[model samples]
Target: MVERVVATEEAIQLINKLKSIHGPLMFHQSGGCCDGSSPMCYQEGELKVGASDVLLGHIGGSPFYIAADQYAYWKHTQLIIDVVNGRGGMFSLEGPEGKRFLTRSRVFTEEERKELQL
Candidate 1:
């Protein structure tokens, strides 16, 4: 099975660091203005996920999700979660860590699309 989302080693390290301090974590992708679209990390259950949200996959042992509508726009690509210097979203847990979680994507190949049944 192919994963729709994955994290870089650096990002995973940071996630582990955050987890050590905050316990289990979760991620959510949104289309809100500003940096809201950046993957937002939160302690699991910190933010409520409802019927409008869809589970994309997991990264660093945490679940990653996106708004159902947002998923529609990103479904054809694989989301690469990485960490970069700077503040993350105003509401994201990483904002205070001096590193932001960035989301990069690559278009799925024909084979991968077929494997994933896209």
Candidate 2:
């Protein structure tokens, strides 16, 4: 099956590093504002997800989600999580690691859409 969210090699490496320090982790796409669309990483259970959140998929064994309202606007695209040199969300695990998680995306191809039954 095609993945709705995936990570780049560099991102996977960073994720492993963070996991080594923080244990397990999760990610949430910030809607905007302070963090803009940056992906926020948290140790599992550090952040609580509720009915307003939608799990897009997993990257590096970590579940990734987006606010339901944001999902509505992004449902047609697949999320590609990557790591870049910069600061991350203030509370994200990667913030102090000198790297930030970024979101790159592409419109789903017809075949993928069919597989996803979108």
Best by TM-score: 1
lDDT of 2 at 17: 98
Clashes of each: 0, 0
The CA lDDT of each predicted structure is 0.93, 0.90
lDDT of 2 by residue, 29-70 (tens): 858888856899999989889889999999999999899888
lDDT of model 1 at position 62: 97
Which ranges of candidate 1 are over 4 A from the true structure? none
Residue pairs clashing, model 2: none
Candidate 1 lDDT for residue 37: 73
Q: Which model scores highest in lDDT?
A: 1
**C-alpha TM-scores of all predictions:** 0.97, 0.95
Clashes of 2: 0
Whole-model lDDT, candidate 2? 0.90
